[model samples]
Target: MKRHDALIRVAEYDRFRRPTSIRIDVTAGCPIPVVRTIFGAPDKPTETVVNVSLVTESHPTLDPTRKYKDRCRLARRIADRLGIDEGCHVRVDAGPYATYYRVYEIREHDAPLVVHEEHLDRLGIDGEQTVRLSTTIPQETPEQVRERGGLAETLVDDQTCEGVLVTAPHGGAVERGTDAIASRTYDRLDDGGVRASLWLLQGYNPPEGSAVTAHRRWHVGGFDRAVDGYPGLATLTGRAFDLVVGVHRSGYEWIEVGGRIDASVRERVADELRTRAGREVRTDLDRLHLPGTNPRISTNFLSKGGDRGLHVECTPGTCDRHVEEAAAALAETIRRVLA
Candidate 1:
């Protein structure tokens, strides 16, 4: 469809719905390509302020009503590329996946222009705190909370061919849909003529055989061994995979591809994904290296054997809506890179 045909109308656009802001990549190529591959010439990531608490540097002086409308217009264009109905509620999904993400909540204090989640955790402003600042964090008793770390369970599908490892520490109940995303990715990697190990934290009840019996949160708790001394997540680093891939869920429509991938194959991978996922492809810039997967972070995926792993964050919507297509594309991209 033409650009003029894709205008967003909001009968009631709720911003505080999540309080978290997101960015959508609007380049070219819909249902078959929305930034993933459709309808434009622009190759830059567009900002969409979701949770209304957003405070940005650019357009800082703009009135609230005008800003909302402008964001809605940008969001509408993005959704249209994905075949989303006009006037429907939508949010940007790829921005949070960018290799670099501009964190706004830290603005409340004297913080850097851009920050990683790990940095916030170090400041004692953890994932829970971020949720409280943006979206809601459900309250549960310590007895019920998993991070206490008594159990341990990790699954490994090691083929030992390419020395690549695909991991999802937050899989299953830990992070909701992450396990499924990683599962598809694991199989995809295998199908691409390359072999690798896939590790998952499926915290068991009795710590069967070697799996951990505790149900602690992976990201936060995993850091103790890497940074502090927590034993729950200490073992993953020992695997020593050359290229570790830690996948997570995002809040935008496109897959936020990050990491300093070899310049030779970056565009090829992006193009493959654009055509497969039917969403726009965007590289990280505003947030170039997030602590979650950056090698600088002790517990990150990139710190593995080759220190070459990349952190891929996909929006909840895109992950669900384009899982099959995305898996095939991702596998193909890896195959191309290996070739």
Candidate 2:
């Protein structure tokens, strides 16, 4: 058929009876080719690469309408290449004209018409990708890990390890602890060739000691563990703080203690930690209030916000030992919060 004549017929067919979505891929010889003709046309075809599957569909013609002129143009070119004839039937099948097409490829040259089909086959185009990570937590009460990100299923039979998955915001590794809600960092490799680490924490509170020292150790330990498991992991970070101390107004235990620290100091601390850990840390100090009764430290670490910090109530009139222990834990919580 004459190219121009073929093009005109294709255009008319498109206007009157175009299917919603048609999938195509260019022949490998023409990695980036233009649609020359539905059957044949003189107009320059729209340019597109043949690396991936292409879906062409008609746009709505209703009021405030969108016209798929480009798509139609491409479709016409494909139809011409396929040698679609007048009797060919095209119909919509799924989701209101989502997945439907009818057109047979007519051989042009006996040299075996070549077109890339792998792109469409690999897409699993019929449905969406299913989330593979597990959401359940087996080590602690599920309630403890609720609302934590990166809470996927455990890969190992033993309860100590949890499988973690990470995705970079912009195709690179994210700072530790910013991606998941675990107590320590766990390294994860994604299918897209990106590396990330998941930090998971098991305890609700930090162990007692020098608050700063204990938390630093915890952070280092978590990172070390992640590195050991995933040698490719460049860094590891994440935080896990007791909600009781972090989210005030939850009617949780916290003590209010008039202290020297100011909001600026807290913010500065938080900033420093973010810089050091390469991740965003969070804490809740406003909600740290005594649960049952007021204590010596009516509210310790009250009005707190730091690079990484958590505020929680301490029992009033508690013995020095208890206060020291609580203070240590609170301090570590701050470190993790900042981490």
TM-score of each: 0.45, 0.17
Give the residue spans of candidate 2 off by over 4 A.
1-124, 127-182, 185-268, 274-339
Best by TM-score: 1
Q: Please give, for residues 164-242, the per-residue lDDT of candidate 2 as tens digits.
A: 2221111101122222222112111222222222222221211221212211111111122122121112121222111
Q: For all the candidates, what are their Cα RMSDs to the real structure?
A: 21.3, 26.9
lDDT of 1: 0.39
lDDT values, one for every candidate:
0.39, 0.23
Q: What TM-score, to 2 decimals, does candidate 2 have?
A: 0.17
